[model samples]
Target: MKYLLRYQLINYLRTYKYVPPFSIFILIMVVNYTFVPNPILNSYSFTSIMLFFLMGWFTITLFHAEDEGQKIITILHSKGQSAYYGSLFIVCIAIGFCLSMVSVIYPILIGAFGEQPRVLHIIMGFLSHFSLAVLAIALSAIFTRELVKNRQNTWWGVLSILIIAVAIVTLKSVILPVKGLIWLFPPLHLALEMMSSDDSLKNIPYVFYWQFAWIVIYSMLLIGLYFFILHHKRKL
Candidate 1:
């Protein structure tokens, strides 16, 4: 199992040879922060943009890697595919959390110099980031599988763009009472919660309840994917 994960890890790292897009994202974040006078707004905007880019590119790269190896269906036959997919998902979540930490801590360190930031806030930031990343990765995993399954769809590209755009817009509107249910989509809700200070809604309805719901849904989807590959292999 360890070797299987390492197999995927090594190949994934090699895929980093084409990392200029990520570098450009970091550059854009830095430029925005350097010019923006309002530190709080800058921090929020920077984190939001970075998360958006990360989720999109990470999804693209995962599917591209699988496609490059011509292993979409072949991977389903491997005894190690379950661990391989699960480990890849784990790695993506870790990368997302680490990136989120960088996004938050970078601004805090620069803007809060002398005014020590609270440890609790930092911890919550991580939890918020991890939960959202897990949610994003789960969706990406499912989407990649579907794309492979429906490779001939003429509108897949258009559908992909629309879905991502809707996700981003939905995330932005999460504070609206009726729209709060959109928070079930991890990254959107996390962004909404992180950007807002109004805890009055917490009394109205437990925020954690919705978050826990997403985590449950995401886990089940992952398990379903695993079973899918296993069942297909059995038939072969």
Candidate 2:
């Protein structure tokens, strides 16, 4: 398991999928903070739009690494199927947390340089972004697995882009059972609720806690689904 993890981490660093999205994220933050004086508005804009799409792309690329044929065989044989996937889940969680923290670093630095926001708000934002990133990683794993199963490797990037694009455009009008379904999408739900509030500190609203709870629940469900898919694929 340790060997497999080390190999994955090395591959992740070498391929450098982390670079482009992270670079864009930093660029967005710098531009917003430089041009727009209000730190609060900058944070809100970052979380609402740039963070979502960039993180989604990052998640997809990370999981897509598993599609490399030789590496997949090496993981299965050396680590055993279950241990290989268990290690992967851990890797994904760690990567998600790290990437999410990277996403928030600019905001943290801006706060440090003056324009201090409530500590509680910063904590909640960190938690929300971390949870959202983990959930995105799990979903991307599932999507990548399905694409591999169907032998549709060519569509991987295209499908990921389309999914994010469609979700952003249609999320508002989605209603009823569908609205309930959309709520399961952590990025959109968290962005809408957290950004909508005027009070970031003094009155830490009930909706923040409510959204956090849902994020935790949905993250668990997605992680479970990721493991189940791995188990089923191992059998076949």
Candidate 3:
């Protein structure tokens, strides 16, 4: 597993697919610092949106890397599907954590943010952003794997426009309870509520506990489904 992870990480570094997302993250930070007196506030406000897209793109690219003929051949010769998926999962989580730290740690380091620094707030923000990125990657992996199984190419442009439109249109509506459906997506619920509140630390325990639990549940579910798909496809 370690060797496979190292090989995959080196491949990602060589391909430069990770560059665009990190570049965008840096750009967002620069713009936030330039225009906003409170860069941390801007980062907190935008982290959900930024990470949603960035991690999605990153996951898509990583999954597609397997589609190349040479890479597929390498995977077959290695420890096979288990090692491949495990290594990919580790890489995705690492990328998510690194990208999330830009929003969490950079703000604290600069000391130009909103309220006086609270340890609880920082911890909660970091966990929430990281979990959100993981969720995005998990969803992307499922989508990519299904596309591969069905022998269909991704239409990223169309999917991007649709996602943006739905997010914008439902941003406010998602807050309102619709038959308790809001609880179904814990990450989105927590992110929206957290970003909306000026005093996020007040209810930190409740939000943090639920978000953490949901992230674990969601990730396991998606990953399990991904392997199930792979198994079924192999049988066919």
Task: In angstroms, give how far residue 14 of model 1 lies from its true place.
Answer: 1.6
| Candidate number with the higher lDDT (2 or 3) | 3
- What's the true lDDT of residue 235 in model 3? 83
Cα RMSD for candidates in order: 5.4, 3.7, 3.3
Please list the C-alpha lDDT of all candidates, in the order they appear: 0.54, 0.61, 0.67
The per-prediction tally of clashing pairs is 0, 0, 0
lDDT of 1 by residue, 1-236 (tens): 56656666576678783276468657855775675344353255446545644655575465456553556554654464555566666666666767777766776766732334455445444545555555555555555553345543313642464266446655564445665554444344444455454322223235644653565475467547656865685578
lDDT of 2: 0.61
Candidate 1: where is the Cα deviation over 4 Å?
36-42, 66-78, 112-116, 145-187, 198-236
Model 3: per-residue Cα lDDT at residue 24: 90
Q: Which is the winner by lDDT between candidate 1 and candidate 2?
A: 2
Global lDDT of model 3:
0.67
User: Which pairs clash in the backbone of model 3?
Assistant: none
Residue by residue across 32-59, what tens digits does model 2's lDDT show?
6675346553365355355545555666
Off by over 4 Å in 3: 39-42, 149-153, 157-186, 200-203
Worst 10 residues of 1 by lDDT: 196-205
